[model samples]
Target chain A: MCGIAGLFLKNRALEPELGAMTAAMLSVLTSRGPDSAGFAVYGQAMPGFLKISLRGAENFDFGAMAAALDVDVSVHDDHAVIAVPLEREARVRALLVQRFPEVAVVASGARMELFKGVGQPDEVSKRFGLVGMTGSHAIGHTRMATESAVTIAGAHPFSTGADQCLVHNGSLSNHNDIRRKLIKEGMRFETQNDTEVAAGFLSWQLREGAKLDEALGAALDTLDGFYTFVVGTETGFGVLRDPVACKPAVMAETDDYVAFGSEYRAMADLPGIADAHLFEPEPARVYFWERAA
Target chain B: MRVAAAPVAVNEPVVFDLAAAGLRALNAALAGLTATTNQTVWRVKNPRGEHAIAVGVTAPVCIFVDGPVGYYCAGMNDGADITIMGNAGPGVAENMMSGFVRVTGDASQAAGASAHGGLLVIEGNASARCGISMKGVDIVVKGFVGHMSAFMAQSGNLVVLGDAGEALGDSLYEARIFVRGRVASLGADCEERPMTDEAAAILAGLLRRADARAEVGDFKVYGSARKLYNFHVDHAGHY
Candidate 1:
């Protein structure tokens, strides 16, 4: 079983503590999934600049790579974030494809920074300095690798749309069929993992002008097999479970925040959790919360 | 003649603070007990949704967990009285042999699943597959039970005081179900049957034992149709 956790803070006062709280939630769920871990943090957005999270192979010279691109970069373990003007994103993508073929673009958004790795959840979070991150909201995942290989690409928080990511807990049976259909529709994929297909499906729907909830509602018909998906978007968080709902999920909401976990243990440490309103998500229903822009 | 002072009675209930003591220590202590154990009362504090609390115990003792618990709480229990003061994760009292398990709050999926002998009382709602494959356990839910409950159950009874979700008691055996509220739909080979006097008595006894307050007349009994017990060419469409 894989574990999924998320925190959406209504109180900006708690923004600085988002990473610490999310790290604690993920750490508590390590026993459910120990193969790999990943997370997406949505912090304050900088005007006129898009943050691009990039991953590379071991010992890649990110500083020199940034200098060559004439951009500023901050390097984490096996990953880096570069700030590029909005107009130059296409040019940077072309350059990375031609010159820095070893680098992989993990995600691109104004506020979201995504990181993932193949290791214990705690080790992966620490490698990315997860506790020090300040964000408005965050989503995390720990993987047990049932349907795919234990690689970073197979990890969760898959982002196919800008500033939009999803973490899944169960396997999809008809992903190959869906993947073929999406490829014919001009969507790209990175791994054989089924979760990536789900992300691509949502991205395609969003591109076609379906709102997040509408995309999720459409997913209930197209996707088959077990799934409990927790998605993070530019301004919202959404949850959905399959109609059969074999997978476990618990959610807690308080005045300060709303939290989701694969199990109650993941959310037991949240502030004022004892008084929080806790409930399991109903089957085949889409629940979404968004902040005003 | 000097009589040895009575062995100091460990009268105070033993408080196992999960905040300080690990789960292994708690289960080890419970497992070490014998039928003749004098330490009959155990209080677990600050459970913090820990998994496998008080599992595989054979002694006849009373365990009170102060907060929510993770999966498989009191599983395979034998001759123990376990009570969870808060919500329970999946598989509460799973495969219990003989005992009494009670949850004061809502229970996740598969509550009392496949328990052979016991009495499980849930004061709040029970999620999907509650009492699935139950053998001899008597489960009483004060609130609604989710879909596919009592699926393929072999024996025993499931009493729901509130509505039941889709497909109640699908493909069941001798297991009897009594629902005082609406059933969304019946599963394959499972159908509602008129409550006989004997069935009413059984339901009354269970409600009393579980400390539930309900009118036996309000319940609708359900059981297997027995048509699927043996496969035949005529039933191939159902298969």
Candidate 2:
């Protein structure tokens, strides 16, 4: 068992509180998954630049590495964010690969930055000041380590694509088979996490031009397990459950925001929750929400 | 106006806030009022997706929960009228002996499974396995019901106003299934039978008790074929 929570602000006025609200929601779900925690936040995009969030091993010099890469960087405790030209991101990643092999680049997109760690959710949130950061939307996870051992790499909100990440609440029974199939198709495995396989599947689908809803709808047929997934992308978010819906998932939508949680208590503290339209996501159905461009 | 559950009772309904008082305190208070039939009402605030909200109730009291609940809320209730203003998780009012459990919003799987007596009403959709293995209770759903509903049902009636999901009433027995909307598919040993006047009256009476206004004429009834009822050597394959 695990916990997945996500929030998308319908009104831009609430964007500044995205991290705080999502932190509160994730905090409530700590009881569901106490092994590890993580979150991804989508901030305002700067034209022509991509924000790369990375975590490195002990004693890795993030400042010098940012200087060497010729990008402006913001350093947190152990995580750092670097803003580089979108056209040069490939070059930047290749450079990191050659020089900073010990560093792991988790997520990179113009609008998003991801952070994760192996610890209690509340402490991790405080470590990164998750309650103070602001963004347009965000998703979080508290992992119980049912599918894989408890490690920082096995934590949830696995990012396998640019600006795309996913958090899962149930174990994937067929992941080993599917992971082998995906690995044969050129997707690299970062850890033994089944959620990474799902993230890879969606990333591959999205790379193949499938929309978020279409990719999620296809997942309903292809992925077999008692699972509930909340996915975050560059411009939108999507939610899906297994055909049987053995995992618990509830969603609340108000005029200002849309929130997803494993249980209602995780979302009870959100704004306008008392009047929100709350319902459990149906089995094999994709519930996708997006910002109107 | 979203919080109101009174029927001219003299007692100022006891209020318990789950966030403050906790589940044991709220449940003990409700259990404390089991001996009296003084038309008492209890208002619960901030339920926060807790399970077994009013489980194993044996007295005639009124309960109003203001928030959503987790699994088995109101399970095994008897002689109480419970109303949840928000959604309910799996097995809401499951194995109910007697009472009226009303959900103003949707319900998760197994809305009223194996209920012996009572009326379970859902104003919104009910997910998979709604009323599975029902014994004698009556279930009324105003919106859609998900797949495999009323599975292995032995007795009682399941009424749905909207569409039903795949394999509804699979392996059904004795329990009457009435769906006003489309039936996706029937389970093994289940078939659609014509609604007789007697079945119509039963449907009408259940609808009245549930406070639903849909015409019984709009419903299509389904039930067991009785093919699996008696053991026979030649029909062994059907079993």
Per-prediction DockQ scores?
Answer: 0.75, 0.58
Score chain B of candidate 2 by TM-score. Answer: 0.92
Candidate 2 TM-score for chain A: 0.97
Per-candidate TM-scores read: 0.96, 0.92
The residue ranges of model 2 lying beyond 4 angstroms of the native Cα positions read A58-61, B1-10, B37-39, B227-239
Estimate the lDDT of model 2.
0.88
Please give the range of 10 consecutive residues that has the lowest summed lDDT in model 1 chain B.
Answer: B1-10
Name the best candidate (by DockQ).
1
| Global lDDT of each candidate | 0.93, 0.88
Q: Model 1: residues >4 Å from true position, as ranges? A: B1-11, B237-239
- Residues B93-209, candidate 2: write the lDDT tens digits: 999999899999999988998899999999999999999999999999999999999999999999999999999988888999999999888888899999999999999999998
Interface RMSD of the predictions, in order shown?
Answer: 0.6, 1.3
Residue-wise C-alpha lDDT for candidate 1, range A1-293, written one tens digit per residue: 99999999999999999999999999998998999999999988989989999999999999999998878898989999999889988998899899999999999898999999999999999999999999889999999999999988899999998999999999999999999999999999999999999999999999899999999999999999899999989999999999899999999999999999999999988999998988889889999999964
Give the CAPRI class of candidate 2.
medium
